[model samples]
Target: MFAEIITIGDEILIGQIIDTNSAFIAQELNKIGVSVYQISSVQDDRAHILKALREAESRSDIVIVTGGLGPTKDDITKHTLCEYFGDTLVENHEVLLHVEEIFKKYISSPISELNRQQAWVLSRAEVLHNEYGTAPGMWIQRNGKVVVSLPGVPFEMKHLITTKVVPRIIEGFKRPFIVHKTMITYGMGESAIAEILEPVEVRLPSEVKLAYLPSLGSVRLRLTGKGPDKDQLNALVQSEANKIKALLGNLIYGEDGGEPIEELVANLLIQKNMTLGTAESFTGGRIAQKITSIPGASAYFKGSVVSYATQTKIEVLKVPQALIEQYSVVSAQVAEAMASNLRALLKTDFAIATTGNAGPTKGDADVEVGTVYIAIASPKRVIVEKYLMGSQRDRVVQKSVNKAFELLQKEILKL
Candidate 1:
């Protein structure tokens, strides 16, 4: 089945707010084996929204609309949908009770007439109750197509879709099985990876497709397969993934499902029953923050020292003051020293350190704006690498952090 998502908000059109609702809706729809034909964002104006609705309905079997569902004056989705479906507004007692209960339990202020108006839904549509908010969702079927209007608020829309809309769609429609496999690779650019995977891509089955998604210093290779038999589709995807794994080997660090390099490194540390720490300079505490973002990180992650200043590197991390004068702060020597000292200070089996000049201008050390040095100090030896990233400060920092985790993961694998 094919679906279309329409996000209605002047804020999105004007770039004041991002349309995250559409992305979430698309992912959920894809999980149910529904292909997203098009995603659109329209202004809150009634005419624009009506035009988008008509266009989406013309091409898609399922049209999901979000936003402009509040009780405020600018909220015109319910009224415009009523016009589209040729129905009138009628009071729903169940919705009214839900709104009343929400107001009585959550809000201390007395409910106004506008809040009460949330109970009035389209006469011909099925009222999908929203337990999270006052705005109720509408499920309208015209001819053979389905139109589901959800609240613009993300949580409310997500709750309704997961609890009501998806179940109903599953019961009403039969969809094919879709499987996706993603491999995370670092220390290589997209162009290089694509060149290496050209033969593999050409040999892929007709049911499977390959896509490369790159960010900063890493690239993600995603393999998607579609078929009627779930087991066969999964096996095909796995077979293809194994082929790519044989080609890439250690360059591929982890898989998809939010397991990035930091998570991969954390899991390796936990599995080996070893602890880790970090000493960061130019990357700011990003390396440490990524490590701690994983749940139960304290079991393997000891702590981090953000020795951003030269004096802090010397005083806190115990890097020699003379070494800073010798090789400057943004050199590989200082990165190695920082990592080794941090490992000793924190009493961890392994440590990762980063020092770089991430800026629009050259640093006091006379290095280029994007010059970075990352080091991983393991129990046996210390490995250091230098990189000349782009001039963008955020990009340089991100690349440095990613490279640090990648290098750390590589060293941990040897253990």
Candidate 2:
């Protein structure tokens, strides 16, 4: 079955409010084997709403609409929907009571005519009750097509769609079976990963589709399959994923769209009952911030010191001034000193340190722009990595943090 989503609001068109409802609806519909053909954003006008509704209904088996249902005079979705369906708006006593009860529980005020008008429903539409808000959802049908109108508020719309709308649509449509698996890869750029897996990509089954979604530091390879049964599709996707993993190996960090790299590292550390700390230079305190975002991080995360200045690296982190003078601040020797210094200072099981020129300009005569050196100091070993990142300062900082986490993970694996 095919579906179309219409998000009705001038706010969306003007970029005042993001239309997250369509994305939610699309995901839900996709899981249920219903294809979302198109998504539209229309202004809060009666004529435009009607035109969009007609166009969506003509092309889709299911039409989902959001917004324009409010207590104010500008809200005209219910009236326009009534006109389109050749019906009239009539007061729904149950919806009015719900509105009054909500108001009494919260505002403790008398009911107004505008609120009553807002509760009014189209005569031919099925009322989808809203538990979280005042506006009741409407399900209207015309010319063998389904049109579901939901509240624009994200929470209220989500509840109605999940509890009420999705169930009804599932009952009416013969949905096919669909499954999706996502692989989260790191330590490789999108182009590099693609180039490495070019042969596998070329031989992919027609039923399975692959999409690369790249973010700041990693790429998520999502494989989606649609078929008539569950077991076959699952086997097909699992086989494809195994092939991709064998080709990519350690470059594929976590699978099935797992949490951020920090979470991945935290899980590994927690599993090993290991403690960790950091000494930072160019990335400030971002690495520590990412580590602490994981719950129960204190179980393994020891501490971090932002030694951006050479003086801080020497004084606070106890990096030898001779080392900085001999090898410069953004050098492997300084990075190793910072790591070993923090490991001893915090008395943790492990420590990670970064010293880098994350900049749009040169930091040292020998070290060009975006020169980064990351060091991991464990009880048994000390490993350092060198990378000449791109010219973008923020990208250099972010990629440095990710690489530091990757190094931490690698050291943990060695242990």
Extract clashing residue pairs from model 1.
none
100-120 in candidate 2: lDDT tens per residue?
Answer: 888889986777888777678
Give per-residue CA lDDT, model 1, range 1-415, as digits (tens): 8999999888998889888998899899889899999999988898998899999999989999998889999999999998888899999999999999998999999999999999999998999989889999999998889999999899999999899989988999889988999998998999998888888999999999999999998899999999899999999999999999998887887888877778878889989999999999888899889888889999999999998888899999989989999999999899999999999999999999998899877666789889999999999999999999989999999888888888888899898
Best by lDDT: 1
Error of 2 at 342 (Å): 0.9
Scored by CA lDDT, what does every candidate get? 0.91, 0.89
Q: Once superposed on the true structure, which residue ranges of model 1 sit more than 4 Å away at CA?
A: none
Error in Å for residue 131 of model 1: 2.5
Off by over 4 Å in 2: 257-259, 360-369, 391-393
- In angstroms, the error of model 1 at 333 is 2.2
Superposition error at 137 for model 2 (Å): 0.4
Which RMSD values do the candidates have, in order? 2.0, 2.2
Clashing pairs in 2: none
TM-score of each: 0.93, 0.93
